[model samples]
Target: MIYLDNAATSLKKPQGVIDAVVSAIQHSGNAGRGSSETALQASRTIFQARQALNQLINGHDPRQIVFTHNATESLNTVIKGIFNKGDHVISTVMEHNSVLRPLYELEEKGVELTLLSINDTGTIDPEAVNNAIQANTKGMVITHASNVTGDINPIKKISHLLHQHQLLCIVDASQTIGSIPIDVRDLDVDILCFTGHKGLLGPQGTGGIYIRPGISIQPLKSGGTGIDTFSHHQPIDYPSRLEAGTLNSHGIAGLYAGVSYLLDFGVDKIRDYERELLNFFYQELITIPSIKIYGHFDSNVDRCAILSINIGNIDSAIIVEELIDRAEIITRGGGHCAPLMHEALGTREQGVVRFSLSHYTSKEDLLTAVKCLKDIPKDLN
Candidate 1:
C-alpha cells in the first residue's frame, strides 16, 4: 500500500526506532521508581531521549523538555495550566482540535478566548495577532503550521510580538517539529509542543513540551514522582513539575532513535526533499481542472510537505474510498478535526482529502497517486 496519510502519523519509522522500542520493553523497568539495574536502564533511556529532544529544538536544557503521551496532552498541559480565570488567550482557526478543544474548555471555565480568523487559503496574518491583544490577554497560543493546509506560521515573529506585550507564548508544533527546523531558544517561545509519531518518525505514545527558563506551567495531573511522594503538592521543578507517574519509556526510547536519525541526517535535507514531492504532486493536481487543492500554492514558499484536495464536487470520503480500493493509496478525508479551517475554505460539508508527505515519500509514489487521480473519472463512469 502507498501510505500518504503522514500528517496523521508517520507509518515508516527507522530501523533503529523499531529496535530501540523492542529493547526498551524487554530490558527497561520503571524510571525514577527504583535503583535496580532495569530501573536505571529505563532512567538512562528516558534521559537520552530528553537530551535528543533538547538538541533537536535547541532548547536551553534537556530537563526543560517534558515528556507527555502526545501533542494533545502537551498542549493541554500548557493551555489548561498556564492561564488564570478571566485571562484571555489567542489562537487561530487553522489549529487542530487539540488546541481548540482545550481553549474551548478553558472558555467554559471562565477564561476568555480570542480565536483569530484565517484567510480562504488558511494563512493567518501576523498583524491580526497584534490587533487581538487586550489587557486581559495574558497569553497567546498558535500552531507552528496548519495541519490541514500546510501553511507555516511565523512563530518567531509572533513570539517576539507577544513577548513585547508580556504575554506568554505557546506554539503547537505538532506538524512542523521534525520535518521543519525549530530552535526553541532562537524562537524565544515560552512553550513548544510536539508529537514523536508524526514528522518525528517515531513510534506512537510519544510526545513532549519544551518550556523556556523562568516560565512555569502548573501540573495538569499529579501523582508519584519517586522523590516527592510525601508532598501533597506537585513538585515545582523543571521536569518533575510536569511529569508525574511512570513515563512511556518504550515509546520514548524509540523517539530518541527517531530524533537521533533526524539530527544526523539533517532536517534541512529532509525538508528539501519533501518539498520536491509536494511540488510534484501539486503541479500534477493543479493541471486537473476537476481537482480543487487547498492552501496557497507557491513553489518558493516555506510550507510543510502536505496537500489537501477534492476530486470535483464529489464527496471527499467517496473519492478517498475509491483511491484506497482501486489504487491502493491511503489518504485522510473529512474535516480533519480543524472545523474552523473547513469553514474558512467553504468546504465544511465536502471536507478534504489530505495527502501529507515525508522524507520517504518518493517521486515515483507521487506519480502513482497522480495517475490514480487522473483515471478516477473514468472509473466513476
Candidate 2:
C-alpha cells in the first residue's frame, strides 16, 4: 500500500533504526540498575541516544534532555510543572489538543490564558502574541508547526520577544523535529517538546523534552531514579529531576539511529524533497474542480509535506475508504486530534482527508494519488 500518513507516524523508518532497536533488545539489560557488562552496555546505549539528540538540536548539554513516552506526556510535564494558579499563559488557536486541553484545564483552575487567533492561512502573528501578554503572563507556549495545516510559525522571533519580556518560552516541536532545521540555542526556546515517531522516523513510544538551563519545573512523576537512593525528595537535577522509573531503552536506541540518519541526510535536503512533492500534489490537485485543498497555497508562507483536502459531494471517511480499498493508498481522515484547528479552518463538520508525505515519498506516489482521486465516481448514490 502507498502510505501517505507520515505526520501521524512515518512508515519508512531507516534500516539502521530497526537494526539498532533489535540489537539493543537482544544484547542489553536494564540500563542504570546494575554494574554487569550487559547493564553497562545498556547504560552506554542510553548515553549515546542522549548525545545523538543533543547533536540533532544543537543543544549545549546532553543532560538537559529527558525522555518520555510521547509528546503528549512531555507537554503535560511542562504545562503542569511550570505554571501555578493566577499565572497567565499565551497560546495560539492552531495548537493540538495536547496543548489546548492542558491550557483549558489550567484555565478552569484560575490560570488565565489568551489564545491568539490565526488567519485563514493558519499562520499566527507574533505581534498578536506579544499583545496578548499581561502582567501575570508567566509563559508563552507556541507550536513550531501546525499538525493539520503544516504551517511553520515564526518561533525565533517569538522566542526573542519572550526573552525580552522575561517570560518562559515553551515550544511544541512534535511536527517540526527532524524535518525542520532547529537549533535549540539559536531558537532560545526554554522548553521544547518532541516525538520520535513522526518526522524523526523512529518507533512509537519515544519522545523527549529539552529544558533550558537555569529553568526548573516540578516533576510530574516521582520515584526511584537509580540515583540518590537515600533522599526522600526527587533529585533536583536536569534529567534526574524529570525522569522517573525505568526508561524506554529499546525505543531510545532506535531513536538515536533515526536521528543519526537524519543528521547524515541533512535536514535541508529532506525538507526540500518534501516541498517538491507537496508542490507537485498541490498544483495537480488544484486543476480538479471537485477537489478542495486546505492550508496556504503559497509554499513559502506555510510549508510542510502535510496536505488536507476534501472531495466535493463525498464524505471524507468515504474518500479515505475508497483510497485504501480501491486504490491501495493509505491516508488519514479525521480531526487529527487538533479539533481547534479544524474549528478554525471550518472543517469541523466534515473532517478533511490528510495526505502527509515524508522524505521517502516520491513523485510517482503523488501521481498515483492524483490519478486515484480523479477517478472517484462523480455520481453519488
Candidate 3:
C-alpha cells in the first residue's frame, strides 16, 4: 500500500528504532522501579531519549522533559494543570482538538479563552495575538503549524509578543517537531508538547512535554514515581512531579533510537526532500480542473509537507476511498480533529482530503497519486 498519511502516524521507521524496541521488550525492566541491571538499562535509555530531545530543541535542561502517551495527554496535562477558574488563555482557530477540547473543558469551568483567527493566507496574524490579551490573560497555547493547511506559524514572533506582556507561551508542536527545527529558547515558549510517532519516526504511544525553567505546572497524575514513596503528594521535582505510574520504557527506547538517527541523518536534509515531493505534487495537481487546494503555496513561504484539497464539492470520504480502491493509496479525510479550522475554511460539510508526506515518500509515489487524482473527476461524472 502507498501510505500518504504521515500526519496521523509514520508507517516507516528506521532499522535502529525497530531493533531498539525489540531489545527493550526482551531485556529491559521498568524504569525508576528498581536498581537491577535491567532496570538500570531502562533508566539509561529513558534519560538518553530526554538528552536527545533536549539537544534537538535546544532546551535548557534534559530533566525538565516529561514523557506521556501522546501529544494529546501532554497538552491536556499543561492546559488543565496551569490555569484556574478566572484566568484567561489565548490560542488560535488553527489548533487541533487536542488543544481545543481541553481549553473548552476549562471554559465550562469559568476559565476564559480567546481563539485568534486566521487571515486569507491561512495563517494567524501576530498582531491579533497581541490584541487578544486581557487583564486576566495567563498564557497561550499555540500550534507550531496547521495540520490541515500546512501553514507554518511564526511562533518566535508571537512568543516574543507574549513575553512582553508577561503571559506564558505553551506550544503544541505535534505537526512540526521532527519535520522542522525548533529552538525552545529562541521561540521563548514556556512549554512545548510533541509526539514521536509522526515526524520522529518512532512507534505509537510515545510522546513528551518540555517545561521551561522557572515555570511550574500542576501534576496531572499523581501516584508512584519510585521515589519519595512515603510522601503523600507527588515529588516536588521536574519529571517525577509530572510522570506517574510505570513508564513506557520500551517505546521510549525506540524513540531514543529514532531521535539519534535523525541527529545523524540531519533534519534539514529530511525537510528538503519532503518539500521536493510536496512541490512536485502541488505543481501537477494544480493543473487539474475542478480541484481546489488548501493553504497558500507562496514560493517565499516554508510550510509542512501536507496538502489538503477538494474535488468539485465531492465528499472527502468518498474521494479517499476511491484512491484506496483504485491505487491502494492511503490518505486522511474528514475534519482531522480541527473543527474550528474546518469552520474557518468553510469545509465543515464536505471536509478536505489531506495528503501528508514523509521522508520515506518518493517522487514516483507522488506521480502515481497525482495520476489517480487527475482521473477522479472523470470517474465521478
lDDT of 2 at 151: 85
Give the per-residue lDDT digits (tens) of candidate 2, residues 1-381: 899998899998999999999998999887778899988888898888888889989998999999998999999999999988999999988898999999999899989989888965578887887888799999888899888878888888888988889999999999999998889989989999999998888889999999888999999999988899999999999798888888888999899899999989999899888888899999999999889888886767537788889987577888998889766899999888988888888788789999999989888988999988888855443
Query: Candidate 3's residue-wise lDDT over 182-212, tens digit each?
Result: 8899888899999989999888999999999
For residues 233-281, could you state the per-residue lDDT of candidate 1 as single tens digits?
Answer: 9999979999999899999999999999999999999888888888888
Of 1 and 3, the candidate ranking higher by lDDT: 3
| Worst window of 10 by summed lDDT in candidate 3 | 295-304
- Off by more than 4 A, model 1: none
lDDT agreement with native, every candidate: 0.90, 0.89, 0.93
TM-score for candidate 3: 0.99
> For every candidate structure, what is the RMSD over all alpha carbons to the true structure, in angstroms?
1.0, 1.3, 0.7
Q: How far is candidate 2 from the true structure (C-alpha RMSD, Å)?
A: 1.3
What does the lDDT come to for candidate 1? Answer: 0.90
Candidate 1 displacement at residue 134 in angstroms? 0.3
Clashes of each: 0, 0, 0
Rank candidates, TM-score, best first. Answer: 3, 1, 2
Off by over 4 Å in 3: none
352 Cα displacement, candidate 1 (Å):
0.3
Top-scoring candidate (lDDT): 3
